[model samples]
Each structure stands twice: as C-alpha cells, then as structure tokens.
Target: MPQHRALLIGASNYDMRGIHSLPFIPGDLARLGSALRRRGFKDVQVLSQLEGGKQLGANFIKGCVAGFLRRAGRGDTLVIVLSGHGVHAAGRDYLVPEDIHEDTHPFESGCVPIDWGRDLDETPADHVVFLIDACREGIEVASMSVAGVTQWGRQKTDAALRRKVAYVYGCSPAQLSLYVRDHEAVTDGVQCGTVPGESFSIFSRAISDVVTSHQGALALDVFREAVQERVSLLHQAYRKRGNPQLLRTITDIPHNAFTFLPAAAGRHEAATPPVTEYPATPSRSTSPWWSTPASPPSGLRPQPALTRTAEEDRLIPPAPSHSAAPGRGQAAGPVGLPPRLRGSSPGPRHLISRRRVLLGLAGTVLTGVGFTAWKVIDASTPDRQLWKFNTREFVQSSPAVAGGVVYVGSGDGKLYAVDAATGEEHWSFATGEWDASSPSDSAVKSSPAVADGVVYVGSQNKKLYAVDAATGKKRWSFATGGEVYSSPAVAGGVVYVGSRDEKLYAVDAATGDERWSFATGDRVDSSPTVTKGVVYVGSSNDKLYAVDAATGDERWSFATDFHVESSPTVADGVVYIGSYDAHLYAVKT
Candidate 1:
C-alpha cells in the first residue's frame, strides 16, 4: 500500500525579542498529530519546542525538512505543519528560525523563505501541503508592540506548480491573530485557547476540529470552504476581522490531492461523522471523494509501530551566516534602530506656551512649569548625537565588550554583536530561535555576560542561555517557570539565575541542565552575586535570600516592608542590598 509522510513543527516558545510565546501549540500538535496517526499516517514525525525543547519551522528546511523531502519519491505524500511566528521582508515572506535576529539580517538570514524550489523538476514529490498557523499578516494589538509581522511580496506565487504546492495561512499579514475568550456571538464550531474557554486562537482550533470531524476522504477544496465559512461566521458574530481562505492552493481539478490516492489504505477510507458536535456540511468540490466501508474491515484498527520501508534523509546543513558585520574595510551606514511598532505611544507632547517651551528647552525651571511636555536634553547639550546607533527602540540594556566587539540586547528582539569602533553588526542571535526564550514579555532584558568563549544571558521569555561568544551559535539554554530578568553568574561550571516564577535555578553551564532550584515567595529579577559557597539575590516578595550554591537550599532570608529588585553585593563578611522601601541594609554573612 502507498503511504504518507508528515513533518510537524510546533514552536510554542519563541526567542525573537519582541514577539511572544504560544504555549497553546503543544495542545495543537497532540490534538492534530494524534488524529492524523489514527487516520493512518505512520510516518508522522514531530518537532515541538514545548515537548522536547527543539527549534521549529525557520531553520528546519536545511536540517530535517529537506532530508524528509529527498527520501520521498514520485508518489509519496508530504504534509508540513508550522505553528509559530512569521515575518515578511524584501518582497518575500519568511518563517522565523528559533534564533532569528531581524536587526542583524531582516531579509535573508535568521529566516526561512517560502517558495517552490528553484527547480520544480528537482523536487521529491508533487503533492505537498503547508498548513501554517502563523500570521502572514502583520499583528496589531492595542496594548502590545509586535516587531516583525510585516509582509513584502515581489512576485506572485508560482502558477506552474499550483497543483503541487499549497499554503494555508492562519491570518493575512495585515493583522494579528488574537487568542480570545468565547464571544458567545462567535460561532460555536470550535474555539481554541490555552485556558480552555479563554485565550483561544480561533484559526488553529478550527483546522484541528475540521481534521478530526470530517466524515470521509478530506478534500482540500472542501476544507477550504469550511474554513472560510467558519472564520467568516466568526467575524460576523463578534465585530471582528479576518478571512481564512484556501487562497493559493487547489486546482481546477477540484479536490486536488485529497482525492489523489483512493486505493491507498488508511489514507482517506471514509468520511465518518467527525468528532465534533457541529453539523458537517457536504463538500463544495466537484471532484470525487472517498468513504470507508460501513464497518471498515474487522481487522483494521490503529496499528502498532511498523518497520519503515522508505529511506529517511536528513536536512542539509546551513552555511555560515553571511550577514555577519562586514569587515572594517567595508563602507556601511551606522547601525539603525528597528522601526517603531505601530500604534505606540505618541512621541513628545508639545508645550502650550512658547516661553515655557523655550525655558524647558533651555533647561531653566519655571515656578510651576505648567507645561505638559518637556524634552530630556537641555539647550546646553549638543543637538546631534555623535554617530548614534539607532536601534529604533528603547536601549535599556547595558553593553558588554570583548575582542573589539560590543554585545547588547534590544527591545527589537536581537542580541547584536557589533564592531565597537564602527557600530557595524558582526552577528546577532534571535532569542526564540534557540532555547533562549520567547520575545513576548519585553523578552530580552538581561545584559550579556561573556566568558570563556561563551555569552550568557536571561530573557523575559523565562530562559537562561549560553551561546558561542564568536559565532552566536547556541551552546545551551535552561527554562524557568516564570520570566527571567535575573542575570546569570557563572562559577564552578554552573549557571545561577532567577525568574519571576519565584525560583532561583542552578544549572550546568556546559549542558544547560538544571542541577537544582530554590523557590521564593514571589518573582526574582535580582542578579546573583556568587562568591565562596553562597549565592546572594533578592526577590519581589520583599526579601533577600542567601542560598547554598551546590544544594539550592536557603541559608537565611532578610525581610523588608517593600519588594527588593536590587542585587546583592558582598565584601568581607558583610552583605548589602537596597530595597524598594527606601532603605539599604548591610547584613552579616
């Protein structure tokens, strides 16, 4: 019997600096993958960030995806599911890699370009489907700032291979996909959310529900119509927006690949009543559909793992980063800030009185000022920045230097390694690309700590990471239950850091494995000072803790009336830290 193959990628946590993580994705895969397996795809392989701590989508083409494609011959089938962030640049759309740094290479690097192969003839199979539950359209949220959601297109999709290639986008590049609570007004078809009734991304859940409930051989065209209606109805029910169309897939041939392999067992035996409460509508395609026998043969049931017959190839290795900062000899513009996010707070407000504005500009204090606006710079200050490196966003992070290179994190979701002298980028690491963390939560805030050919840092995405100091390659990363604003202190082959999830973690520096953890009452954003056998840090729970480095056991804690975000320092036997309560304490070790 002919068989089917699938490569599923679910990136629940992103490392991109400004983007957020999608914790609901593991549910997406477990639900979808389980259903597909039951539908008879024996070769369903998955790469999920939530389950196994792996990268997905962006960099997979060279690593695992290509291998799977090459091993697939003429009649073999391929289905790919990408669930994560997507960005557009230079007239093209791309899926971000686990480590995408748009600040470093917005066009080509740190991304996966979507297109039919340059040589369609060289492709492994003609039947390929890409069901992407990502924003092809840019995102817009009143309270959030998203960095890389814009789409740029230079050429139309390939019409020659229309029948062989299909793309399903969750939402267009013009808007964001929201995770909403059931607006009872919305259709009751299927609402997806991490909190069950809340935080649902209606798009992904609809596809999963349709896949599970379809009665017979699922035709691509029919699936498209159902999605269009469901999404359309959803928009109508709640004053919402968005259209999920089959858009660029399907042919005049109607059913496309859904009806391609009728004789193949377990492929599309029958369109039994789908596993949903909503009534299933008859398909709109004119192409023939298949159905399983009233009682699929007595012997047919979910099968156990079978010996593989097809050769499984591996993805090609990626070439070294070509976007590294140009050598000093090259001429380049000064580093620029990322574009400001849309709908951000308005820039400096204007003062009403010209005299007050003049005084404000002159840095002279007026009795009441009585002005709503004021610039930070005084008239005495230079009007122009001396070759400023515009990051296009807030540069709250401190800078670190080594080997004439300056390393810094940005609100735009990048850790830029730039030439100290010229301000040209040498390389950058996108957070979500590796195990570093999601860019969501003002993601990369901790400063880089470079040591022993490695760079270590923390992110609001709740992870601590160690990357190659020279190449930006990820060495290892460890996740915490909450946001990690705590900087890591390395000593004795261990990495110590804290998280908002109220725990301090001691992980192996080399393997990125957690050795031990000590829980605090609240969040821990305080960087630790490790010396001797004790680690000193502060927590939002209004306390400072001294923990044993090796055992993760607390030795003692000092309480204050207010929270403590300040790190601790030690000299001799005295330990000192400041508290939000407006007091500084020096405790004896």
Candidate 2:
C-alpha cells in the first residue's frame, strides 16, 4: 500500500461562550495522529492552540499548505482533520480556530468554510479528506453579533489545482454537537483531579473507533454502521442526562476513492438466496388440487349402461328424461321410456341409476364452485403476523422493511427494529437526543431508509445518522448544513437529502463521502425525490428544482406559492408535491 499524508488540527478555545470546552483536545489529536501514522500515513502533522500563539490561524494554514506541497502527489492521499467550533455567516461554513476573535469574519478568520472549493484546486493529491468537528452557524443555534465585525478574508494562493476531495462534517447546520462527562475513562479506572464539565463528543469517539477497529474497512457504508452503533448506545446511556445530538455531512469528488479496498474486491457480499421461508405457515394452503384426493359416499350405486341400436348409437341421440317411477312403481329405461315389463313399467334399479347420475353431476358442479371460491379467498388473504414490539416514544416515520425486519426511528431518539409481520422489537439503538423539530410531538418523526443493510434517518436535533440494520451498531455520520428533517434517498451508491440549512447534499452511500451540493434560497424541508438521473426537491422559498443527480446542476426550477415543505413524490413521469400554500402541484417531467 502507498503511504498517505495528513494534516490534523484541533481547536480547544473559542471567542464564543459555551463553545471552548474541549478537555481532551491534545489527547484526541495525538491519538488520532498516532493511529493514522500506524495505518501507513508516512507524513502526519498535528497542530493545536496548546502550541501557544495568537497567530495560530496563520501558522495552521501555512503548515497545511506546506504539508500538501511536501508529501501530496498525483496519486497520494491528503487528509485534513479539524476539530473546533464552527460558525456560519452570510451563507458560508467556517471552522473557528481557538485564536479567532468575535470580530473575525469567516473570510477574514482562519476558519475553513463549507465551500472550500478553492482549496481543492490548490492541493495536488489523488484524494483529499477534509474533516471538521464544529458547530455550523445559521443552522440550529441562533446567530450572534460581535461588535466591530471584520471584513471577509481571502486565500493566499489562487492557483487552480484539480484534485479529488472528500469533505465530512460533524453535525448538521441546524443541530448542536454533544459533549458528555468522561464516563468511559471513569469506568476504565482512569482518574484525574476534580474536573468540571469533562465530557467526550459522541461523533468524535465514533469516528476514532471506526478508524481503529475496522482497519481497511474504511468505506462510508462500513464507517456509518460503526458510528451509528456507538451513537445509539451513548444515546441510551444518557437519555436522562440530556446528551447532545450527532449529525453528519459529506461531499465527495468524482471518481474519488476514500477507502483502501480495491474495486474488484468490494465490501458488499454477492447475492445468493432468492427467497426466505415464512416463520409460520402461510395464511393459505400451498397445495394444488391434484395433490389431495376427494372423498365420496361409498353407498352410491353405479349407473347402468344405455342400450341402443347400432345406428342410433352412432347418431348419438340425446338422453331421454323421465319422471321418477310412481312410488317405486316402475324403472325407466335409458331411452326415457318405462322398462318393458313385457309391456309393463321399468324396474326400481333403472330409476335408482338415473338418480345416481343426476347426483354425481350436481356434486361435480358444486366441487368446481368450491375450488374456485377457495382460490379467490387465498389470493385475498393477508400474510400471517409474525412479531410486534413497542418503543418508549412514539413512532411517526414509516419503517424501512428489509431482511424480514422493520427499521424505524422514534421521537425518543432511538432507532428500532421490530418484526415486520409481528411488530416485535428485535432491538433498539438510541440516538441520544430528542426530535423537537417535527410538526407533531412524536418520538421520531423521520422515517428510516435502509439500503445495503444500513439504516439512515434524521432527527429533530438537526442530524442525520446511519446504523447497522442487523445489530444496531453505529457507523459513520456526516454533518449537514441544517436540521435533517428529510429522510435520505439512496441510489447509485449515493445518499441524497435536504436540510433546513437550505442545501441538498449528495454523499457516497458506502463511505460518507460528499459528492456534490446545491443551495436553495430558503430551508429545504422536502426530502429529495430522485429518478432517471434527476433530483426533485421543494424549498421553503416556494420553488421546485430539477437538478442533475450526478452533477448537482440545475436542470430547471418552477416557482410556487408559499413554502413547499412536503416531500416530492415522483412516479409515472410526474412529480407530485405539496405546498404550505394549501395546494398540491403536479409537475410533468
């Protein structure tokens, strides 16, 4: 394997209140750096405010560019990780450095904005991984005004360098990052003097674990599963203590590979089984009519053969009908006349034969009718109920059905698995936060979407999460520009979603890599509807956009009255969406 180069930065101080409490800054950075070096990263640089300098911003950026120039090559990988407070101003994401002042604007401050497109061109590497751990402004929290605001800043190098880049963030714009007391260390017997407000960030821990445990399994899909599992566990542990929510956002450059695995030996397994057996017998019988024998009365007598002239038999005259013999008087002949009693009536046996034939015909007709009825009933019957379970919170989202299970997110900040047929809960993973953003006061308002064995969902805390559908394990998470009210739509190895931060993000479904993004004028409450290479989403700005799913380019946009928060449902060459203006609009593609 080729050696990779990385520049890691962690900021522990902030000009803003309640944002500068990172006690494990040095430990986290050192641990991460050592881990990366062990994983074949030949050149890894770590920088932090603890190094001591008011010029930290200038020094960090200079170091990053220098590292890139020194080790980055056409085929080499460059990873940049930043952990600090993040703020958004004038529609741009900024990673706040410890030395950054209240007056420092993102453009002026050393902060890296979400639109780091300029940096992508300046760095020469096959793949660039940009990780930011911070709170995004203009999102979940209210914006603050600093006295004596400074003007925007500019990048020193303007040279365009085309390179693949993957950007990952810690929380959605509309959400806040959580920190908890150092419970893990305490449980592990590590002791430090009375430390007030000592805690670990849920997402940070999950990321570290993924990089450490999975080793070469660094794809987005694998990472997401691990992170979701951890986050769920943490959520359950601190539900009563008010833990912070974790959100994730990602962007990936075209043809960029983040994981170390070769394409020939992909992580996903090949398909094998075609169908699964039902837990219980099906509601209807599976046997065909020929498989079972029918029972008939043994007392019935056999009918006599008809006697006719040779010429008449060849002509095949219709059988004659006759009334029953009067009180067992005389038997009727097969030709319909009374049997000759030397000119008298027919015998009782003749009458009995006629009755037997009539009864057999009736029975045949009835059996045919009965079989038809059975077929109809079986076709209409529903499958048997297999399982059922309940959650502590209410479930507002539709469940994702896969592998004989139903995966759902609940308002209680937990992802639950119930038997699809029986509704029995197989397992539940907590997300560590409540969803206060839903219109209803339900436990989980976002439905879970499952693909490739991973469940993806958003919460009221303005975060999107991915969990293992089978074991409820945490995977990787990417923060978004805003609260992830919309469920994710996965296709073509990518996941698409909208955020209240007013942007649509396309992330690699496998590795949480950001592919592309498109901005809207207002909040994007509508979940993206993808089809035939196009993405359709509604915005609070009252417009419907048709964008190329691959490139995130705008194909067309249609304006409507009022905000369009309802997710667009696409089918039959038509896009149907609802608007807060009290109307539903149908658009033909």
Best by TM-score: 2
For candidate 1, write residues 402-508 as lDDT tens digits. Answer: 78776777655567777655556778787654322222344466877888888888876677889898899989878888767678889998888888788999989
Q: Give the whole-model CA lDDT for all candidates, comma-separated.
A: 0.56, 0.53
lDDT of 2 by residue, 1-589 (tens): 4457777777765554534446555455665665565455777787765434443464565456555645566666777777666655553556665665444443335555545455466555656666666652222223344211111111111112222555555553334555554442221111111122334555565455344333243444434544555444444333424333433433322221245321212213352112121111111132111111122113321112122233323322222354322322122111111111111111221212212233322121111100110111221244311223555444456666678776777656677886654456688877664444322222345677899889888765566777888888878677776557687898898888887678988988778878998999777768888899999999877799998999999999988755677888888999998864446899987
Per-candidate clash tally:
35, 55
Q: What is the TM-score of candidate 1?
A: 0.40
For model 2, state the Cα shift of residue 569 in Å.
Answer: 3.1
Tell me model 1's lDDT, rounded to 2 decimals.
0.56
